[model samples]
Target: MSPLNALNWRYAVKQFANTTLHPQQLEPLLEAIRLSPGAFGLQPYRLLLISNPELRSNLLLHSMGQNKVTKASHLLVFAAVQQIDEAFVADHIECMTQQRGGTAEEYQGLEAHLNGYFRNMSDQEKVRWADQQVFLALGNCLTSAALLGIDSCPMTGFNPEGYDQVLGLAEQGLRSVATCALGERHAEDAAADLPKVRLPAQVLTRVLV
Candidate 1:
C-alpha cells in the first residue's frame, strides 16, 4: 500500500497481540527514530527498549495500570536530557564535524553558535527544547510503525516521577518524555475492527488561493 493508504489503516491500537515483534521487524522501527530530524541536528533524545516482562509489569503500575504497557511486546520509552549543558552541545558538534572531516577550528565555530543559542535560554526553555526533540523522534517512530503494518499506541498518561525513579533516569541524565507500545493487534480487539475516525480533508485543510 501507498503511504497515504497505510496511514489510513493506522490507528491508536488499544489491544496488542501476545506475540512479540521479530528482530527483523523491530530493527527498522528503531532505526527510524535514530535517523529522525531534530532541532539544529542535535538529537537530544534516547530510546529505552523495554522487553522484560517483570519490568513491564512494574511500568504498568507507573502508567496508571494501562494494560497496553504489559500486553505489548515492546515498550519504547522516549526520553530527553533534563538539561542541554555546554559540554553536551559541544561534544555532539565536535563528533559531527570530525565525521565530516572538518577541523577543530570549524567545529569550535559551530559549537560557539550553538552554545550562544542554548546559553541565552532559561531553564524552562532548555527543557522545552529538549522535549521537542523527543517528540520529533516519537512522530517518526509512529509513522514508521504504521508504514510497516505494526500496531502501536502513543501514550503519555504515565507518572513521570515514578518512572524516573524506577528506571534510574537521573543517573542517565534523562527524563521520560513519552512512550509507545508496539505489537500486532489482538484478534478480539474491537477497536481494530472499527473504521478510523478523522476529519475530512476539506475541513482539516485550507488553501490560500
Candidate 2:
C-alpha cells in the first residue's frame, strides 16, 4: 500500500485484541525508530522496550489505568537522557568515526563544539530538546507499525514521574518522555468505524510564492 493509504488506515488505537506481534512483524517498526531523524544527528533519547507482564502491569498503573499499556504485546517507553556533557558528545563523535571510517583526528573539534552548544542550554532546555527528539522517533515507529498492519497508540496521558520511579530511570540518567503501545486492535473498537476528521488541504496549506 502507498504511504498515504497506510497513514489513512492508521488511528490512535485505544484497545487491543489478544494477538501478539512476532519478532518478524516487530523488527521493521524497531528499525524505523532507529532510523528516525534527529537534530544535529544527535539522538539524545533511548527506547526502553518492556515485554515483561509484571512490568507492564506496573506501567499500566502509572499510565492512568490505560488498558492498552498492559494489553499490547509490548510497551515502548521513550526516555530522554538527563544530561549532555563533553564525554557524551565525544563518545558519539567517536562512534561516527567507526561508522564512516574516519580517524578521531578528523573530528577533533566536533565534540567540544557540541559541548559548547549544549552548555548554553539549561538542564530543562536539554530535557526539552531530548523530548522533542523522542517524539520524532515515535512518529517513525508509529508510521512503520501502521504500514505493517500493527495497531499502535502514542500516549502522553501518563505520569512521567511515576514512570521514572517505577523504571528506575535515575540510575541510568534517563527519564521517560513519552510512550507507545503496539498490538492488534480489538474488534469492538468503535473508533474503527468513524471517519477521520480533518481540515481540507486548502485550509491547512500555504504557498509563499
The candidate that achieves the highest TM-score relative to the unseen native structure: 2
Off by over 4 Å in 2: none
For 10-50, candidate 2 gives per-residue lDDT tens digits of 99987788888899988888888888999878988888988
Compute the lDDT of residue 114 as modeled in candidate 2. Answer: 88
Q: How far is candidate 2 from the true structure (C-alpha RMSD, Å)?
A: 1.1
Question: Which whole-number lDDT from 0 to 100 does residue 162 have in model 2?
Answer: 92
**Model 1, backbone clash pairs (residues 3+ apart or across chains), number:** 0
Error of 2 at 126 (Å): 0.9
User: How would you encode candidate 1's per-residue C-alpha lDDT over 32-73 as one tens digit per residue?
Assistant: 878899888888878898999988888888998889999998
Whole-model lDDT for model 2 versus the true structure? 0.88
True lDDT of residue 9, candidate 1: 78
List TM-scores for all candidates, in order.
0.96, 0.96
Task: Give the poorly placed runs of model 1, Cα more than 4 Å off.
Answer: none
How far does residue 72 in candidate 2 sit from its true spot (Å)? 1.1
How many angstroms is residue 139 displaced in model 1 relative to the true structure, after the best TM-score fit? Answer: 0.9
